[model samples]
Target: MRIVVVGGGMAGTIFANNLARRLSSELKAGKARITMLSASDKHIYQPGWLYVALGRMTPDELEREEASLLEPEIAFFVDPVQSFRLGESHVVTRSGKVHEYDLLVIATGSRPVPEDVPGLKENSVHCYSAEDALKLHDRLQAFTGGRILVTVGLPHKCPMIPLEITFTMHDFIRDRGLIDKTEFYYTYPIGRAHSLENVATWASGEFAKLGVRQETFFNLKEVDGAKGCVRSEEGSEVKYDLLVAVPPHRGEAVIEENKLGPNGWIPTDRYSLHMQGDHGEKVIVLGDTTNLPISKAGSTAHFEAEVAAENAAAMVKTGRAARSYDGKVFCFIEAGKDRATYAMFTYQKPPEPRAPNAAMHAFKMAYNQLYWASVRGLM
Candidate 1:
């Protein structure tokens, strides 16, 4: 059986590694093969970008060679897929190489599209990319005082980052003795501060305690850079000295170009993790590429990858799927520089976040390093 995994982000890496382990015997016997295709040779720890913006981590510390993370049994390539011909059970890469597979895993991940909001790209500082994170770092260092507005867009990766960055920024400024001079203004599109009711409630209280002002029902309409203010879809205008935004996200461009699904998100079965519709059986969708109503987070992808890998391996061994994804998601919320909390939830249960503590923060810090092992399917 040929298993072709597309996109070498967290989802793709973990899934390929796990599948390789499960099919080890078959692989040795030449009965099964696992292949991974990625755009870059470097595997990035994306969560570290948030820390990079705060000068807590460096870009070099967040990246490793992609090939080193995969198992030797799994074939790895740096060529990115340009198009997916699901009907033909194959994908064509930028190098014009076509890979045919009996089973396909789509984990292409998501991209932040700040340009979707008019003037947002030019007017705000974001940590979605390495360059942007460093830019934010410089902006944070030179910032002395004034309004620091944090705006959030929908369907972003890492659901806790908006809150995490806000909390951490407060601590960062406070350490610099600029807390008194800075006013934090946070805005969310929904009626609440977060999508999860319990999380929103917890974060609202935290924000209030930190003296951060919040505006709900606020959507990004446009930014008036000259006036140094942002307009909301709800007809509200707010000014800022520094704008930190968590821009909206969409699945990878390859997914969009192939017309797999709207906005680059493939319609996927929430439980089965399979692509919805006729090609469902052969194609499994994982991570940010899936149109599941869950956080586009590493934990979400990690959980989905486990299920997809297991099911795929089981299908090859037993001619049937062995499991279903229960929408399990876990995230560590950095309450401040030294304290953190975590939220763990499944489809049937909502996450009730605990109070922030130093131990949780330490664990999160440790996980940052251990992520390498985790992606290797060792944990």
Candidate 2:
């Protein structure tokens, strides 16, 4: 049997690695093969990039070669996927190479769609992608002090990241003695400060203490780069000196063209991570590309990979039913002045039901080290 895993992000890498390790015996027997496809040769630790933008971490610390993370035995395809033919049991690469597989796992992840909003692509600086974060970091370093606007475009990855950016900027400016000159504004389309009501209340309080203005329920409509202004769908306008925006997210076109999810995301059972397609039995999906109600964050991807690996291994062994994936997510919310908070939750259950404290911050820091160690097999 041959398994093809697409988009080697956190979820894909972990799932592929886990499956390969568990099926090593089968692999050695020439009974199974595993392949990993990635668009880039480098594997980026996305969560660390956020800290890199804030100057707390360096870019080099967040990136690792794709080969370093994968098992040496798994086949690696460094090319963009052009399309997926579910019925044909094959995937066509951008170079026109077709790969046949008995089982396929889609962890293609999500991309920032700045063009989804009018004028955003041409006007704003998006900080979600690694490239965007680097650009934003340069811009932030040159900025003296002005009305800085941080806004969430819509349906972004790591939902609380923008808020962390805002808080971190506040601390950065305050440390520079430019607090009075810097006017920080945070805007979101969500009705509340954060997604969860309990967390929103705590976040609003944090913003208040940090003297950051909050704007909620304001959908970003267009950006006026020349005037440094952002317009909302309700016709309200927000003027800023520097705009840090999170772009709308969408799944890869191949997944969309195949009628995966309503919004280009792959629809899957919350528990099983099985992609609902014509060849549903042979296809599974996880991470930001899925239509799961959970927050689109790295932790969710990591957690989902655990289940996907078990299910894939089971399918190869006894042909047993796949286990369901419970929605689990953990997030670190930056408070101001070297302080931070963290939260963890599951489906329909709120994250800790409150704001995180210093202990949570310590946990957050430890988690980063622990995660990297796990990836390196040192943990």
Candidate 3:
């Protein structure tokens, strides 16, 4: 049997590594073949972008070579996927190579597209990527006693990242003796600061206490960098000296290019995390590719990887039903340079901080170290 895994991002790498180990005996016996495809050999630890922006960690700490993380028997390909020929059970790469597979796992993650929103491309430096985070770091370093706005575009990844920026700036500016002069403003599009009601209440209260004005129902409409301002759908305007904007995100172009998805996202089952198509257990999808309402976070992808692997294995072995994902998501956001708040929940329930303390902060710090181990299938 031949299997092809596309994209070397979180879900793809985790699934591929685990699957390779699972089928290790088969690989040695010439009963199974697994090939991993990535757009680049660089596998970036995405969550580290936040730390990089805050100057807590360097970019070098989060990057790894894709080939180093996989089993020796697995074939690795460094080529961009042009399209997925689902009906033919093959994937075509940019180099005009075709990879046929008995099973295909899709995990090419989403990217922030500030250009999608008018004027945003000119005004925003985001924490969504290493390059973007480094740009933000430079902007923050030069800032001296001016209004800073941490705002979001709709449905962006990591709902808590913008909030983290709001708090991080408080610490960074305070340390530089500029907190008294620099003002903080954070805006959320909907009626609350976050999706979970309890989490929102706690965060908004904290924002108020920190002098970070939190505004709700202020969906971003446009931005003007030269003007140093942003306009919202609610007819509200906020001026800023610098903007850390969480731009809108969309699934990778390959999803839309193959017509395997609508709006650049593959329609997926909420519970099973399977691609909604007639592929008959041949195609499985997870992470940013799915249309689930959960936060598009590393933790969500971490958990979803397990669900997808178990289901894919069951489908392969017994042609049985796929297992269900409870949508359990855990996130720890840095409330301050030293303090953090954590939440855990599923689709039906909202998350509440069990104990938003320093211990959880320690866990998150350790998790970053373990994250690399996870990529190597050590966990």
> For every model shown, what is its TM-score relative to the native structure?
0.99, 0.94, 0.96
**Highest lDDT scorer:** 1
lDDT on C-alpha atoms for all candidate structures = 0.93, 0.81, 0.83
List residue ranges in candidate 3 displaced over 4 A.
none
Q: Candidate 2 clash total?
A: 3
Alpha-carbon shift of residue 329 in model 1 (angstroms): 0.4
Put down candidate 2 lDDT per residue, 1-379, tens digits, no spaces: 8999998888888888888888989998989999888898988888877777777777787778888888776899898677888889999898898999998989988888998887788877766766777887888788898889887876888888877888777777787788888888988887888887777888889788878898998888888888879999877899988888888889877777767776679888788788775788888888999898889998899889878888888888989856777688877776756567777888867666545567767777777667765554333
User: Alpha carbon lDDT of residue 303, candidate 3?
Assistant: 83
Off by over 4 Å in 2: 257-259, 353-355, 376-379
Looking at model 3, the pairs that clash are none
RMSD each, Å: 0.9, 2.0, 1.5
lDDT of 3 by residue, 48-141 (tens): 8988988989999999898988879889999888978888999999899999998888888898988988889888889888888999888888
Q: What is the TM-score (0 to 1) of candidate 2? A: 0.94
Error of 1 at 374 (Å): 0.3
lDDT minimum window of 10 residues, candidate 3? 312-321
**Model 1, residue pairs in steric clash:** none
lDDT comparing candidate 1 with the true structure: 0.93
Query: Which pairs clash inside model 2?
Result: 271-324, 271-325, 272-324
